[model samples]
Target: QLHNFCSIELGSFYLDIIKDRLYTMPADSIGRRSAQTAMYHLLQALVRWLAPILSFTAEEIWQHAPASDDSIFLQTWYELPELSSAGALNDADWQRIIELRNWVSRELEVVRNKGEIGAALEARVELWLAPADYDLLQKLGEELRFVLITSDAEVYPLTEKPAEVAEEQLGVAIRVVPLEDAKCGRCWHRRADVGQSAEHPQLCGRCITNLGDGEQRHIA
Candidate 1:
């Protein structure tokens, strides 16, 4: 059965992808998310094909798939009905989004190179897009924002040359700049002037208190 071979192969393949090179696909290819997506689709096709035969195990696997809500058998067939329609699922759209994400990720990598890790996603990105591109990106809202590892983001027309900002080149290219003199002390993110915690004035107040407890525990 498809499941029999796939279950064994997938575990090994996914681990290899993760441990060896999942994050390092050619920058010119689709981004990390697309790599994840391709793996997911491969498994999904295998699961559904096997569900009719393997029954129980396929459902178990499907249940764990992100955003899958129904029984695998009850879900729509793998093939989409809208392929011939005007709004047919387009490969170009997916490629564009993935490319944009890859571009953004490279920019974040530059920040990491500067000895920072885990910047608060919402506070660290400022996207400058051509007018048409800005309009296209705004439609994605926060889902795309998170994919780019920014806590919050806003899209703007590229009116003039961007201010001197750090940049990274992936499939496309992206720029990253430090936010204003804001800082979140607890997490060490660069937005300290937010939320309402006065006790740790330079730190985001929430993390300040949370860290207090963790610090006490560490001391003991």
Candidate 2:
């Protein structure tokens, strides 16, 4: 579970929430501020939790971190927040999502082997699954795209099983295609609106909107 917490939970928070969404947004934007606040608190909890295992490193981190206490040892044992506090999906939901994401990765590998796409970010994915799985994925909303790390994704209900898939794993099928959009100079994600703005032609719509005079925040 610790491995899952570090790799899946915290990893997703850093990649999807902080890097993908917050970093792409303007420093002064409400979304960026909100995400930063959440990240700050989460980091404090993580440092305290890790202190038992990595005392010296944790203390070093705590010294530089903004907190009420001077030392991490002064803090109480770390308590995980409620699952709902982190996301709408529960453990089971996340497991299914992970499985689906793995399937996408395998399919992306096939296309990558053909030299059709170099990066996962340069691929568009199509997911075909049973009605139940489709419903679960739909609950993820826009986050599904971020979870897959693709330029675009679409979920469809399975009709007839495709010939390419084995019988046992017929419940899910994935297709990866090279992304058609120009890559955004700022975020490096392929987007259709990359050249829409004359002022920031190299950036996507989101990047252009978030282009502010203030320095962008970096996760140290």
lDDT of 2 by residue, 173-212 (tens): 7778798899999878898999998888898876776776
Superposition error at 43 for model 1 (Å): 7.2
Show the lowest summed lDDT stretch of 10 residues, model 1.
211-220
TM-score of 2: 0.81
lDDT by residue for model 1 over 1-220, one digit each (tens)?
4545555334533343232123322333334445566667676677778787889988999999877887998976685222253633245754565566656666677776785644535245676666655666766664344445454466665654365642343212255655655555434345435555555566654345444332111000
lDDT, candidate 1, residue 26?
38
Residue 84 lDDT, candidate 1, scale 0-100: 50
**Candidate 1, backbone clash total:** 11
- Clash tally, candidates in order: 11, 0
Model 2: residues with Cα > 4 Å off, grouped in runs: 1-4, 12-17, 78-87, 160-168, 212-220
Q: Which candidate is the best by lDDT?
A: 2
